[model samples]
Target: MTRMPRRSVALAAAVAVLATACSAGGGAPKPKQIATGYTATPQQTGAPKDGGTITVALTPGLSPNYIYPYPPAAANGTVIGRGQMWRSLYRPSGEGDQVADAELSLAEPPAFSPDRKTVTIKMKDYKWSTGTPVTADDVVFSLALLKAALKESPANWSFYTPGQFPDGVSAEATAPDTLTLKLETAYNPSYLLSMLTLLYVMPSAEWNIAETGGEHLDFKDPKNAKAIYNYLTEQSAEQSTFATNPLWQVVNGPYKLKSFDPTTGSFSLVPNENYSGPGDSRLDQVDFKAFTSAAAVLNQFKAGTLTVGTLDSSYVTQIDELKAKGYSVYGAPAPARFDALTINFANTVDNFDKVIAQPYVRQALQRLIDQNGYIASRGIYNGAGSPNYSTAGSGSPYPPAFGDTPPYPYDPAAAEKLLTGNGWKVVPNGVTTCENPGTGAGQCGAGIEKGQKISFTLASANTPAYVGARDVAFSSAAKKLGIEVKIVTKALNYMYANYGNTFAPATKNEWAMQDFGPLYLAAGYPSSNTVFNADGSFNLGSYRNAEVDKLINESTFGADEKTLSAEVTRLAEDLPVLFFPTPHTLVVVKDTLSGPQSSFNALLSYLYSPEQWYFHS
Candidate 1:
C-alpha cells in the first residue's frame, strides 16, 4: 500500500499525450493476450501513434551485463527470466508458458533443418532508432564475439559456452536480411531459438573492432578490440550504466532504444516505423523510471503516476490491499531462477566417495524435504511450481515435459532407510555415522575422530525469496539427517564473490553449499563442465563427479536431445546441487500494460515493441 508521487503521475500523463500524438496514422496492434486486470478499449487504427517515452522501474538495479541476449549469461539470464526483456522470436502469450509460432518482431517464423541441426533467421525490416538496417552481419559478429570470449577469457565466459557453435557450425550472412547458423550436429533446435530470441542484434559495424586482435584489441584504444569489449563489459548491470548508441541499428524487433541516461537512471523507447507486423502502436511512448525502494514503486502505482512496476517480497502479503484500492494486480509465475542450494562439494569432508556417491543417498536427500509447503508458506507468486532434479527434471527426465514419475518425493523415512541401507548407522540423537568400510573401529561413525561432521554454512543473498526459502527448507531438511546447517546472508556483491575467477580457496572451504541460478541455457540443456570442472571458474560448490562431469561434456556436443537426455538422466541420478523447483518467471504488470505475457526468452522483444501496447483513453 504505497502511493504514487505527484511528479510521477504528471510525468505519466505527459507520456500519454506523447503516445497519442505519436500514434497518428500508425495504429497500435491488438496483441493476442490482453492485460490481466486493467481493461482498456483498443486504440483505433491511425489513432494512438507510436512515439513518446514510457517510464518503467527495473529491479534492484540495471547491470550492463543485460547485453547477453537469448542464451543469457548467468546474470543477464536472471533479468530476462524476470520478464524485463521481451522476446522477438519465440514469445509466449503470458509468463513462461508454451511458445507462440511467430511474433510481431520476427520477419518470418523460425525454420529448422530436417535433422534439426541448423536454424535460419530471416530479419524483419525493423530499424533501430538511429535508422540503420539490422543485418545478419550483426548476428554473426555477436556469436563470434561470444565464441572468442569463451576461448580467451574463460573466467569471464564461465556462465556460458561456445559449444552452441560446434566444430562444423558457423554463422554467415546468407542474405542482407537473413542469418543462417549451420550446426555441427542435430540437437534441440529450441536451444538456438532461445538464445537468438533475447540476443540484441548489435550493428556489426560498431563491434567489428573487437574481432581484430593485437593493435585493435586494446581496451583504451577507441578503435581496438579492447574498446569494443570494454563497451559491452562496462555496460554490464554491475556498472548500472544504461547507455545506448544512437548510431546502433536494430532490424529484428519492434521498438528501438530511444534515450538512455545513466545519470538520471531513466530510459525511453520508441516504436519502429518500418516494422512489418499485424496490429501495432497503442501507446505513443514508454518512460522507464528507476526507484531504489519497492515502497517507492508501490506508492507511484497507487498514486496513478506509473502504470507498470513489480511488487517486491515485502509487498507480496499486501496483494489484497492493492486490489481493494482499485489496482489491477496480475500475478504470473517466475522461473526457478535462484531457488537452489549449490554445495561446493569440492571442499566438503562428507564422504563424497562412500556417502554422496550413492545414488539413493542423493535421492533420499532430495526427498527428505517438502517443497510444496515451503512454497506455500512463502506465497510463491504463481501456483506453477515443480520439484526439480539436479538436471531440471521434475517429472520427466526433461523439463516442461512434466514426466510421469516425480523424481524425488519428500520422505524422511525413505531417506533414513536409504542411508542405513547404504552402510550408515543411526546414533542415539538422530545423528548418523558410517564406518570407513576399509578402516578399523576408530576410523568412522559418531563419537569417533575417524569421521568429520557433515555440516557447513550456506551463503546466499539477503533477498527474501533466497534467504527465506533456502534457510527454512534446507536447514529443516538437513537437520533431520543430523547435519547442522548454518545460513549466511550477504549483500549481492559479497554473495556472488566467487562468480568467476575471484574465489579464495579458504572461502571456498568454509562454505559447503551456496545458492545459484543457471545462466540462461540456449536449448535449456544442463552442462556443468564449465561450471563444475575441478578447477573451472564457476565450480563454486566444488562438487565434482567424474561421472557427472563426463555426462555434461557428452551432452554439450551430443548429436541430439535423446543422446543428451541419456547423459542428463545419468547426472540427475547423481544429484549435485539439490535442484528443487525450476519455476517459470512471474511478471506482475498493471492492467493498463497491454501485450503478450511472455515465454522462456521473448521478454526483451516484448519491451522493444511496447508501443504496440494499447491503452484506453
Candidate 2:
C-alpha cells in the first residue's frame, strides 16, 4: 500500500481503495440491471475551466494513516494520495496491454542485457518541487531502502519474494541520469517491469540522513538505509504532521499535500506547480473526503456535496435518481482485479489446513461457490459481477479453456459426493466427520483425525453488503452438507493490516477464511508470484505446491508467454483461494466534470490521475 504499484490490497470497503461495487437492495424496484462496460468519455461544450475545486470520496475507512512510500502490511493503506503526491519510478498505465505508461514514467523503458540478467535505465529530465533534478541516485536510494525494508520483515513489503528482485538484484547509478541493475537470475522483461512499477523514487540527497537536517550519508550502506527508513516510518506514524511535514513536501508528482483532518482521515492537495510529469492540473485543489460506509457516500451524492467517487451496486436502483441529479455513474469490470475467500493454510484450527490440503476437498469447496448464482440472484451481485475462473480476471488471455468455462461449477450434490467419497460421514444439517483418515484412496487426507469435525470460521468484511451476502450464501450451502461455516464480521482496514498470517503471526489461528474484497496486482501482468509462492510475502493462505511454484517461476523468469498461461491455468485448478465473481467498478462523477474517457480508468482500480481532470460547462 505504500509507494509500490505492485500487489495493492484493494477492497470495496475503502481500505487501500475507494468505494467499489457491492451491497444488495431488497425488493428490486424495476429489475433494472446495473450496467457494466458503460464507461463514457467525458465531453463538455464549453472550454475547460482554469481553476476549480473537487471533493472525492476516499474509500470509507481507508484514509492514509502511513505516508511513507513503503509501509509494512500492518500500516499499509490505499494508494489514493501516494500516487498523486509521491510518484512511483514508473507510472501505472491505463491500457491493459502495457505495464506502465512510458510517457509518464520517470525513466524511459529499461533495456535488458543479451542474457536478460542485467538492465540499464535512462532517466527523464524531471525536477522535484524543490527545483532539484530527479536522477538515478534517487531511484537507487529507493531500491536500497526497499531492500532494507524487506530485510526487517518480508511483510514490510508484500511484493518481496525470498531471494528475488531486490534481494537478488544489485543496483547502482552508473551516471547522473543512468541506473543499472545486475541480476543473480535472468527475468522476463514484462515480469521485471511489473516489479519496477512498485519502485517509487525519493529525494536521495535530502533523505539520505537518518535524522532531521543531519549530514547526508551514503544510502548504499545497509545500516544507513535502514536507519533512514526507520526515521521516515516513525515520522509517517504521526498522522497529524502529514500536511506540515517538510519531508513529504519535496514532491515529484502532480499534487502536494495542503491539509489533513486526522479525525476523518480526509486530506487536501494542491497542484505541484513544478511537477514534471505528463498531465497538467486544471483543478487548483483536490480533496479526498473519507466516509464510514457506502450509505454515507450515497447521502453526500444525494446532497450534491460530492464531486466524483465510486458508488456501491447495492444502490444500483438509485442510479436513475443520481442521473436526474446531474451525475454520471459508470460501471466496468476492473482490470487485473480478483476477489476470493482467501484461505489460511497455516490455520490449524479444527485441522482445517490439513483437510483443505486434499485436492478433492479443495475441489469440493470450489464446487460450493456458486459464482454464477451470486451474479444472477438479485440479492447478491445482481448483474454487476462477472464470472472469472482465473486470477487474471475478466479479460485475461492466459489460463486454459477454463477461462470461458469454470473448472468447478456450483453443485451441492457434487460437494457432498466428494466429502462422502473421501471417507467423511456426511450428515445433512449436522457436523460432518472424517470416518477414515489415511494417505490412501477413499480416505480423508493425512493429518486429519479419524473423527475430525468439518467446521471453520469465515471472516467477512463488515462493509459493502454484497460481501456478507455472498459469504452467507456459501455458508448456507455448506450447512446442507453438514459443514459448519461460522461468519464473523471485521472491518476492511483491520483485515488489510492485521489478517495476513505470514506477516502478522499473532492472528494466524484467529480465522480460517477471509474475504476483505478484491486485491489488484500490477495492471497488465497479474502473475501470482509472491501471492501464492510458498514463501511469498502476501501468501496469507500459506498454500504451497512445488509444481505451481515451478510454473510461476517459469512465467516470471522465463520469456515464453504461454508459460504465464500455464501458470494461471494451474492456479485456477489448484484454488490457492476460493474464487468469487469479479465485480464491476461503479464510479459516480458529477456531470460538470470533463476529461478524456481514458481519465476514467475506474476499471484499472486504485491509481487516480486527478491532474488530467478538469471542470467544464
Candidate 3:
C-alpha cells in the first residue's frame, strides 16, 4: 500500500480496485491505437462546456462491504467503492497514471517533511452540502474512527486493517483547513501516504457527539461498545439519507448527490455551482444503472442505450466484430494479477500431508500450466505484453520495472523431475503416487481417496473467464501433466462469497484447487493474514504454513522496500498459490471521452472521475 503523493507516488492503490488494472510496481505503458481501424487522437484540453448529463450502466456489486470508521463498519478501505459518492483530497490524473493537481477538493497542496516522513494536508475552504466548512476535526475523527473500529472489530480486521498511518502517528490541526500528520519512521511512506487518498473525510460535528462524555466507548465495555457499533452501522447504512442534514457539510467536488432511487437502482448528482474547480460541472443529470446480467448490458450497448461494458477475453471476439461495425473498442493490458492455485497444506487431505507440504508440488503445478498460451487464448496480451508472475509484473506492467527478468519459465520436463525426486514415483497409468502400501482409512497422493490419481477442482468464474475458452485452455494444459481437474463454475458473486472463505459443511465436498484471483488490498504484495493465517477468515483451504505466515505478517507491520519486494517474490516463487496471467482491461467509450486512462498496477473503478468527464458535443 504505497502512499501516493500529490505528484510523486504512482496510482498503484487506485488501480487495484479494478480487476484489469492490477500492476506490479511501475505504471503501465501509455494507451496507443490498437489498429481497430480507428486512430485515437488525444482530445483537446480546457474545453469545458458542462451541461449534458452522462448516463453509465455499471456492473452490479460496486458497493463495498463497509463504510465509516467504526467497529464492523470501519477500516474496510474497500469502502473506496463508495468513491463514486464521495471525493478524496487527491485524485488520479485523467491519464490514470498518477495523482495530478488537486481540483476543488484540497484548499492547498499537501506539505511533506523534508525527509517525507510527515505530511501536512490543509482542507480546502469547502463545505458539505449543509454549508459548514470542512475542518481538521473531520480528518481526526475519520482516523480515530478507523483506529477504534480496527481495535474493536476482530471479524472485520481479520485481514490487515486499513488506514494504518505509521508506527508512531499523530494528527493535529494548525488552522481551520490545515491538518498535519507526523510519522515515526519513514521508508517509501507511499503505502501509508496513498491511504490518505482513500480516506473519506467525516463531519466533525457528528463525531463530537459520538465521542462525548470523557466516557469513551471501549471494546471491553459491553454496553458502550454495542451502542457505539450500532450508531456507526446505522450511519454507514444511511450516508445518502443524511446527505442533506443542515449539520452536514459537503466538500467542493464536481458533483453532489441530488437524489437516489435505490429501488430503481438510479442515483442523480447535481453539480456544485457554488464551488470553482478545474473542470466545469455541466452534466445536468447523472444516472447510474446496475445490470443483472452481462448480456443485458451488451444488449443495451447493442441498442445504443448503454455507455459502458466491462470487456474481457470472452467479449474480445465480439468486440472485434463490433469494431468492424465502426464501434470504437479500446483495450489496455492489465498488470499481471497472479491468479494462483493455493494449497491448504495445513488441512490434511489424507495421509499425504508430507507429500503435499513439499514445495515441489507447488512448483510442479506452476510449470504444468503454460501462461503464454493461456494469455494468448484469453486475449490478455493483445497489444504488447509478456507473461508476468506479479501483479505489477517484474516492475510496472506498462512502463514495466527497469532491468528485471522474468521468473519461473514454463518447464514441464523439470516439473516431472522435481516431483519424481520428491519420492512420488510416476506409475505407468500416468498416475503418480507416493511410495506407500496402505494408510489408516483414507489414502495418499494427489487423487481423491487414493494416491493413484492426480485430481483437483478448479473453482472459477461462471462467466467467460472460467466457463468459456480460458477454462478450456487452462484445463487442457493441466491435463498434459497427467492431472485430472474438474472445472467448477460458480456465479461470480457466489464465487467471491464461498471461495473468499472456506466452504461450509452443507456444500458437497468436491473442490480442491481454485484458479482464483488474489485478495489484494492497497498493500501491493500479498499477506497471509487474509488467506493464509491459520485463524484467518479467508483461509478457505485451511492453509497453515507457519513460515509463510510469519513472512507475510512481518511484511505488513512495516517491511523495508527490498524486504517487502523480496518477501512478495519469495512467496510467489514458493508457489503458495500457482500464479496465472491477469486479464487485460478493454473498454469501449464515446470518442469525446478524454482522460480515460486505465491502470495495470491497481484495481479499477467506474466512478474514478465521473465528475471530471465532460462531453465534446
| Top-scoring candidate (TM-score) | 2
| Residue 260 shift from truth in candidate 3, angstroms | 3.9
Candidate 2 per-residue C-alpha lDDT over 1-617 given as tens digits, one digit per residue, 9 for 90 to 100:
11122111122232211112224345554323455324554554456888999999877656666778887655664443878888888887766566887877899999998899889999999899998899999999999999888888877777888888887899888999999999999988888998888889888878887888888888989999999998888888888888898998988888999998878778899999898777779999999998888889999999999998888766776788998898987776676778888889888888888988888887898899988878765566756778877878767656455657778888889989999899999999988999988978899988988989888998888767677778877887788888998888887766766778777789988889998877766667778888888877778878899999998899889977678878888888888889899877778888888776667763247558888878887
> Judged by lDDT, which candidate is best?
2
Ranking by TM-score: 2, 3, 1
Q: Residue 575 lDDT in model 1?
A: 63
Global lDDT of model 1: 0.47
Please say which candidate is ahead in lDDT: 1 or 2: 2
Scored against the true structure, residue 310 in model 1 reaches a CA lDDT of 57
Residues 1-617, model 3: lDDT tens digits: 21010000012221232224223225433222232422232334345565676666665333233344322523332342245444555543222333333553444566677776677887767665456676786676565555555555544433343333422567677777788887765424434434455566665554443332334443324354445545656555554553453322243455565655444445556666554445545567666565555566666666666544455344454564555443455543332234456554533333334445556666776776667655543233333223556433323312223234445567878777765665556553355665442332223333324354555566655443322334445555556656555666555555444443333423324455554443333323323335555555556666666766665555544534344455455556666566665544455554454432322112232334555566664
TM-score preference between candidates 1 and 3, better one: 3
User: Model 2 Cα displacement at 228 (Å)?
Assistant: 1.8
Clashes of each: 81, 2, 37
User: In candidate 1, what are the lDDT values of residues 1-617, reduced to their tens digit?
Assistant: 00001001132332343344235344432111211332222222223434344556655433223433422233422222112222333442222222233544444666887777677878766554346776666666655555544444444443443343333567778898887878777545544444444444545664455322322232222234334654455444432333343223233444555555555446555555664454465456667676554577778767767665555533454554566664454433232132456655555445433444445656767776566544433333222344455443332224422243456667777877765665566442356666344233323332323344445566654342423343545565677787666666544434554432224566655556655332322224333444554544556555666766665555554445455465555655566657655443323444444544332123321233354456533
Lowest-lDDT window of 10 residues in candidate 3?
1-10
Error of 2 at 233 (Å): 1.7
Error of 2 at 360 (Å): 1.1
Clashes of 1: 81
The per-residue C-alpha lDDT of model 1 at residue 323 equals 62
